[model samples]
Target: MTTVLPDLRPGGGRSQQAVGMPELLQVIWHETRTSRAAIHRARPDTRCDLRISASAPDRELIGTILLDGDCACRDLLVDMLVECDRHLSDRAGLLGNPLGAARVHVRKKAVHDWIRRRRTEVGAQARVDRIRTSALALGLPDEFHRALLEYLADEAGVMAPLDSEDALHRRLATRCAAEFGGAAEHYRARVAAGMTLVERHCRSGTRVNAGTAAEPDKVTWWERYIERPMGRRPRRTDKPLVTAAPECGDGTHQPPEPASADAADFDAQVVAVLVAALRRQPVTPDAALRAGLDDLVSQGLLPQRCAIELCSDCNRFALAAKELSALR
Candidate 1:
């Protein structure tokens, strides 16, 4: 008897001889991860020293190396330190210190405090910008936008004395729906988006009160009526009916084309695969693109024939996952 060995090439198993593009992508991803892990293990705890310099108004500094594993923070500290030094030298005798050494300490502390305050203000402004952008995207009115900013700034009290921002937003959205006659769901979505923006900004750093600006455009009373629910209009029987004759010429009307079952099944399969992949691992852009595709292919949900179209769809899903992750 002659001994025969099985072909062990990519996708050469008994199931299917040709590998799908998604499976090939998975192989590449696995190899890439293995290589990265090996490289990380080979050179773990590697230290890097960086030197940064900037030109000041009246300062001549050669260079300084910052160490502490956070080069960006160190660079910022050095810049702030140099700025304080310049301020001290400029106001040598103005601060009642002839040698400028005694007041240097005080001036340094003031400079650092100023920087902290400025950073807080900038972060607050960023949060306000995000809230405004979200409101604009939701098509919220100018009055509602200002109210949201005020709420974020803690300038207004909640209706039911709620402790959390979420509760406050819910109450405010309900009030907005009642007052504006707009869709409650739309207002709730806008409020949620605004609250999320403020919460994310607060979590990142110290919270500061956001300044409120005048509304960009004024809404007239007539414009407000547009948001209100409109009554059904009466039907008119003025036009005569005009139906086209059958084009087949046999006097038999051809039936309308039915919806594609294959397309619907493909979409449902794609969603199922994405949900399974996300549940397996937290959805990230990289993980969704590679591992998600791998999961779909391995689970036999994605067909080899539809690999190319599915790959494009997977890319879109990956981008959406990234945006959702960022919001979280």
Candidate 2:
């Protein structure tokens, strides 16, 4: 006798009694013999030839049962299938259509969800692998590596407000240079290399480069003072030089410049003062002038009679040095 099997439902549910033989066979193949062992044991006897009529829904249900290892409803489906098959065989008049004419529809949501989940997992693993590889390649000490990672994360947080990725990268480089005591250009190069490796392997398309912000220039204390219009004056006061008695013939004492001296004489005296100031190797203009005057007096270059006149000339030279130093 040719027994027609019922069609299988989309989700492996029991077939309806009103449905034809095609649907019945679908249920038997998909819901009942879902496993290889079940299929082997449930084979029909040689005298009772059995034929299956499977639809698209039946194929999908069978595929899902085979693929999903943790399908909790399989036992329930198997029990339902056995009951249906027994009922169908008991009624000899019932008939099922051929498998070719059967049409079945399967819900695609589960399949789609499974694919999406797999992709997400793959992407997450790729990211993890990329990070681990990059970290190992860095070869920094464990403590330093941890600190560097923390610093980078903190920097990224600070840069979150930046609208442009390029700008953010550049700012990060600048900050890294300042905090880590490395050249910004070098830091940028390293960052770029790391990002490139990540993008290539992880398939993340994020791009970052160093920012254009310039570091502030350093100014020296001397430069700071000299840049000003009025330079700092010497703090030291002039002290009288102790000299040997003239009777010893160490040097002749020249007379001081008279108040009524000619303009030429006054100009000559001013020139002498500046020449003295330039001779000293002191750092500041004020110190230079003071040391110059002291050297001239101690070396007996200046006459004892011109002590007052030379002192007054030294003061003028001090002012002149201030202006010259400021320009420099």
Candidate 3:
């Protein structure tokens, strides 16, 4: 006979150590896979497969779950976030070749137009912020909170360049990652130190989430049916999310700008690349600007201001450096 695991949900106390990040992630994926419908609701929530949508309507899809206190589907928030990011990136030429990466470079104006066209895609941050609201209201384990924030910060870095309209905190966090070290360490530290891009939401809107359990416990049922590695499987979430057939690179992404298109649009792409560089991820500002100037400048950008600006001036760059010197 298959034996069910004991309830191991951590009590709201320090004595119980939170599960490690890798294991916590596994548990979350499993919850996403196995989510069930609540017994009662205005309409029987029919999204049983839990396949997440990659379009604007995903807000409604995720909202349906987070707001429905009866199902307590908030636990799947992390996985939902993961799926959204993957779908968006994949659709945006996530492949590293210049052509693919170029296709990934969707301009902000076009980003809106693209979304307007048919709700083709969604970015990760906004949706995760929704989860952030719930996570804050119904407390999460300390490590879990930090990890969630770190994940947000990391995703912010990944998505920052593609869209310039990103939050300043997130942009700066990625900039810090670029200036200091890289996303994994620098922003991870900031998030642990209580800095993150998560802005506060309206307090009154959170009331509907009250009845749901803070986070559902994970199951160890896999240990019964199979070995540790392959045994684990996630249940499908009850409320199904939209899914689509794959496209070559990004389905909605326009082809690379033609020679006739405004050259400035192509020049702006350097910003995305440099931002990535500063964050030290895939590598994007001065660097971006230099590239833009390299192509646009008839005489090319000046190498220096008489080669003495750094040595002679008390400019912001100089002042900034001196200020930084105070750190150590």
- Please report the candidate that would top TM-score against the real structure: 1
Off by over 4 Å in 1: 1-67, 71-76, 93-95, 98-147, 150-276, 281-319, 322-328
Tell me the lDDT of candidate 1. Answer: 0.40
Candidates 1 and 3 compared: the better one by TM-score is: 1
TM-score result, candidate 2? 0.18
Candidate 1 differs from the real structure by a C-alpha RMSD in angstroms, to one decimal, of: 26.0
| Model 1 TM-score (2 dp) | 0.26
lDDT of 3 by residue, 154-204 (tens): 343231122211233464456556645667345545553443222222222
* TM-score on alpha carbons, each prediction: 0.26, 0.18, 0.17
Error (Å) of candidate 3 at residue 19 is 58
lDDT of each: 0.40, 0.39, 0.31
Q: Is candidate 1 or candidate 3 better by lDDT?
A: 1
Please provide, for model 1 over 12-57, each residue's C-alpha lDDT reduced to its tens digit, 9 standing for 90 to 100: 2222233322333233333234333432443334332433322223
The CA lDDT at 281 in model 1 is 51
lDDT of 2 by residue, 25-47 (tens): 35444523333233233322212
lDDT of 2: 0.39
